[model samples]
Target: MAPVPVAEGIFTWPSDEPQLIGSRCTSCQIVTFPVQASCPRCASTKMEAHLLARRGRLWAWTTQEFPPPSPPYAGPTGDAFVPFGVGYVELGGEVRVETRLTVADPEALTEGMEMELVLVPFRADEDGDEVMTFAFRPAD
Candidate 1:
């Protein structure tokens, strides 16, 4: 089965080292993830597509003890549910992104530890294709 992106225009495809796509305001030099058309800080329309830092440091994290709400979370259901880690990764002080953590063990996680962007299987489509999404993991 072919692997597909969870969302398009978020990261580059067929890459060895994936970098997030973001929007940078030309006026204020502010960067935003998901590539905003207008600057959130200064409301400037002079935004340009920018590639985000692939490596960073873990800032903070926590484990989701319960499964998230349905209708929005298209993940495992009922007994198939598994808790996951979520945290903020500060990318070279350019931005702090709240992303899923690949580390399931809490003990393995430490604040200020080096991290790198990684793509992981989020779910499978009805066609049996795997849907991949971005996550942060301990740097290699």
Candidate 2:
């Protein structure tokens, strides 16, 4: 089975180095993740696909101690579930992306710490294919 992205167009796939896909407002220049059709600042429909910075600073974070509700959360559950880190990482002063963090220990994570984008295994599908998702880890 082949590894697959959690969803389409969230990040660049089939590449050695992947970057998150965002939308920049052609009018106001505001950037948003998951690509938006309209600008949140100016409400303009003119938006373009923007490749976000691969590195950033951790702005804020917390741990998801429990499994998120199933409809939107497709990862492991019950005994298979594990706590993971979640945070917003500010990329190139363009935007702050809310993402999963590779480090789960809050003590190990600090605000303004340097971070880099990475792809991590999210879960296995019914077909046993690996589902990959984007995350951030402390930059060396």
Candidate 3:
């Protein structure tokens, strides 16, 4: 299990939900994932942060066999193959999010599979308050 930020304001979690603070351009009516303070296309700075929908369609995915370095990620430390998945999630309106997948088994995942987002606890310190994160789950 691991947590990583795939884009600005877009964080991916092990079993957690994937959330991307997003912005919808009022002028062009285009929604962008990983919220932008200013529109990259039209240079409009009138952007608002919006919570994206939990459900997304599988765009792509992959696995990681090598352990990620410390500092940013604090997950299992081993050489064993850790099968992971990530891809673009189409949320309609031309809005797509890059995030990880939550499948029972990595091998069972496929393109165009429906996915649902879930907010989950990542780690807890000595104080016992769980530091939370987000990821995507297969939609039921």
State which candidate has the highest lDDT.
Answer: 2
| lDDT of the candidates, in the order given | 0.89, 0.96, 0.65
For 1-140, candidate 1 gives per-residue lDDT tens digits of 99999999999886888888888899999888879999889999999998999999999999887879888999887898877889999886888888999886889999999999999999899999999999998998
**Candidate 1 off by > 4 Å:** none
Clashing pairs in 1: none
Give the backbone clash total of model 3: 6
TM-score of 1: 0.95
Off by over 4 Å in 2: none
- Per-residue lDDT of candidate 2, residues 78-138 (tens digit): 9999999999999999899999999999789999999999999999999999999999999
TM-score of each: 0.95, 0.98, 0.71
Worst 10 residues of 1 by lDDT: 75-84
Candidate 3 wrongly placed segments (more than 4 Å): 1-20, 79-83
C-alpha lDDT (0 to 100) for residue 58 of candidate 2? 96
Residue-level lDDT tens digits of model 3 in 16-41: 44555678887776688777778878
